[model samples]
Target: MHGKTLTFLLLLISIACLDLLLTHCGRSDHKQKLQKQDTVLLTKHWESPIPHQEIPEGLTSISAASCGTCHAEIYKEWQQSTHAVAFQDPQFQAELKKDNIITCLNCHTPLQNQQEFIVRGFINGDYKTPWKEVNPHFDKSLQLESITCATCHVRDGQVIGALGSDRAPHKTLKDPGFLSEKLCLGCHNVVDEASPQLVCTFETGDEWNANWAKREGKNCISCHMPSTERPLFPGMSKRAGHFHHFPASGIPKFKDREAGRLESMEFTESPVHPGYSPGDLLNYQLKIKNSFAGHNVPTGDPERFFLIRYQWMDASGNILKEEVHRIGEEWQWHPVAKKISDNNLKPKEERVYPFTQLLDRAGTYRFRVEVTKHRMTEENARYNQILGEYPLSIEVYSKQYEIAVE
Candidate 1:
């Protein structure tokens, strides 16, 4: 009986050993399959004229100045653009330091990989914290040239664009996607779940897609990066080429140009009397037609807003009575709702503001209407210390009508 029991124990031990060996071999096979898959992906990423090229030796790490050597004209236009100063912009830097939210840097100074930059978070819908370490392979000297030439053109040693076959020192891939809205949407249509409400901080891409731009097949490049007849490369003949300026709503220098795009304010006064007396009520109507902006007037940043302020002023320019009508999204934080109100003028949208003021005193009174653009609201300014300190509020449009009060 003892001998039989000992044989059974040995058999059980042998079975356990066989199971362990099989599991080990299975794991090894699985690991090998994963490694093979990764190798294929890497090969596809580095598919250029020069095979087996290391990332350190690739154009991805090259500075924009290197490209300027061949394409001087295009480079010059890009140098003066907002994209050139995106990371170094005073307002952006101030907000970054004040908020201490390092995640903002992801979009400001994006990764070399366009796909990785676009898909910032994880597949599980979780927000992945960006890597704190600067890439050793990147050109440190060109780090501040935010949204640099490499951001859009260079990808794994290949230059991607919408241009035709051209002989360059490096490999070129003519990607039509560069001409489409897809190129801009990657960074512009971000939806952040970190906020109490899922906030679309930059909604230009979404707005363009949903508005007349999409229906009319008008891409972002059509308006923001309009084509100009000029020589792109040193040896190339003059051709229709798009500029890299990427003009949008916020830049102060472009305020006049943007204002000019709006249809002139249509004013209509009720009780068509030539003169007014004390305690008399007068109604004034103003219509602002958004004829130019393919999207909303203040499109990109959520904090951006516009106000149409109507004031009744005396000959001394003292404001006697005033009323402000906002024409942009109004929001508040803490006990956060999606949006407090959104009166922003949409594409081809017309907004009307009617003002009625009672004559307080009999004298020469001037009725003035001014359109002002604000970087952010007072509540947002309070939260963002830098914004409050360097607030960007400018009058974009203004008009006045003098009425003699009897």
Candidate 2:
């Protein structure tokens, strides 16, 4: 009886050992499979240790031309955008001098040889003319264009996924990889993570993500890189996928339009100014009002601003005098600043104010009022919105002119 019991115990121990060994082997095999899946295969273009070519020395360089070849429309949009003129923006240049760390340039400029750490700049804000006011060694080509497909779409020389992906790096797209909105977070959502600011100024991406994600599902590119149906490239005749000029959507409406906007303008001339003479002073006033906006004139980002430009022109269409008023900032021409109040108007609420300017030596003065919106560098710091100018314009030209000399 004792011998049988001992034999049973030994056999059970041997079986347990075998099971442990097999389990270890299985784990080893699984690890190897994961490693293989993670390994990235380089393309034919990346034969050398470095992925890209030397990028021959030239004023504009060859790489930009390559991008321009396929993305003509994108390039055209970029040309009109401030990304194309980032380096040349007088304000950007001023601010760039303040920061020595080249970190901002990393996204602003593209890498040449896939050598991750090198920072570059546009050879001086010249999109049309390359390399003339040459700031060489800095990338003159593709870098001038803001964010591109290759910029955010490709990761580590591999096309993992596009911008708005839910799964992180190395996750399978079958499970929903990067999408357009996710791509925007990289640059647009830059934060100091080390500052004690009242409101985080540099967290546009984070703010938008928090606000929009819960309400409805939309990505950054959906609004900014919106698509429109155009004839195929180079006029193929059949309709193909043409991205829209406005690539942003899902923005809250004023009643129902974008960002609760109810702004409009019209021009009308006065009957005539009394006691007017040739080469004498004439006064013209333009009425501009913000009918409806949730917050301030240019809400969300504090840096976004509106300016009223009043131009007085003579009957011959010669601009005689001009005065400008900037909202939320100090301007010499006008002494008023943008007002922030609890009673700020919402959709359907309207406020009218007259923009007035005086012209001397006027002969049938023409009055024009322009509402100019600018996304400047300071605003970019706060809202992470790109630097651009948007204008809502209204003009009134005089039918005939008579200036009386005193």
Candidate 3:
């Protein structure tokens, strides 16, 4: 009798858990689930806005300025960061809609308070497809804050960070995940083997040379958010924290002079050849390297590209012959994104671009070579209505030579 009772109790407990899971699955909002197999649903990820929850205690509001009350320096750095204006960026705003979907907001405005809707859960346990609903708890002010302190460091009303501090006004908890690359994975790195994703972040983290970067003891944190000894906040004792600015390709000079470096230029002319005509063939080689970046030189967004130009001209700098090469990926996104070609430099990789020119009637000729980073093409700029903004193209490297022939 006693054994039968125990067995009955265990069976009942299992049934209860199964029922709870089913009910929970049914309640998810992003991908509406139905009992009928005929029903179809849309998909999403890059994680829905963090569901509505208790804000970290002891902070006045969800505004980053509220955190700035204590973490002054970090807050100020964040103000200058691209994350601070993720949603309000003019170019991003212009490119937000396609097929009438605004799903990109998940990464841009990530906190429930910042989002217009909340994802209760995903249907059929498919996180790729979330079940979303109107969020009664939405705060428009937080939307303007974009990716903020709460988005990364707050959960269940506790402050999550790399180090726990007894001195903090609120409960401080240390999460080792903060120190690893996983922290940036959702937005930067993404689902596995899922190509042609409806929304593409352009695979910045996926392109990273993990084996090489790891051998060097570097990662997203070490490269993008190098740590320093500083007070967690102003009055606290010095400890390890990282820069919040999160700089990368957004800063043109940062990539140009540092990561994508122009290493060397080699030139040769065939002047001593027997029976050589009046034309002196000029042979040139230029080396551009993606030495410092752990990922591809231009990793994110198809709009990002490098333009290499070679020109031979009279001493007056009037162009005579010019050749141009574009280094980047091309894609066709009409039906679904399919990469056509990729010539972007990979980690620690160097590419040599060579060209030849013939000089027949040259007294003194100028040879010029240049590499420029183009953040956006003018055609796309006009289509996106950001043409009035300053040209995004920035010169990374250039060289000039005066070749004299008698």
Of 1 and 2, the candidate ahead on lDDT is 1
What is the per-residue lDDT of model 3 for residues 311-334, given as tens digits with 9 covering 90 to 100? 988879899889999888876655
Q: What's the residue-level lDDT of 390 in candidate 2?
A: 26
Q: Evaluated with lDDT, which candidate comes out highest?
A: 3
Candidate 2 structure quality by residue, lDDT tens digits, 1-406: 4674365445435434644765777765754453344322222221112223332322123343454565477556544443344444444444444432233344455444322333221112211111111233444445554344445433343433333334232222221245555554555554431112211133445444444332455444544554555532454443334352332212221122232123422334444453465544444544444332212334343444455676667666688776776644322211322324323222233444354443444344555556554544354434433233222221212233344323
Q: Rate the local accuracy (lDDT) of all candidates.
A: 0.62, 0.40, 0.67
In model 1, the Cα lDDT at residue 100 comes to 41
For 320-390, candidate 1 gives per-residue lDDT tens digits of 88999887777665566466788777888877788888776788888887888777766655555545344
Question: What RMSD, rounded to one decimal, does every model reach?
Answer: 11.3, 19.0, 10.6
Q: Judged by TM-score relative to the true structure, which candidate is superior, 1 or 3?
A: 3
By TM-score, highest first, what's the ranking?
3, 1, 2
- Residue-level lDDT for 109 in candidate 2: 51
- Best-first order by lDDT: 3, 1, 2
Model 3 TM-score, 2 decimals = 0.77
How badly does each model clash, as a count of residue pairs? 0, 30, 6
C-alpha RMSD in Å of predicted model 1 compared with the true structure: 11.3
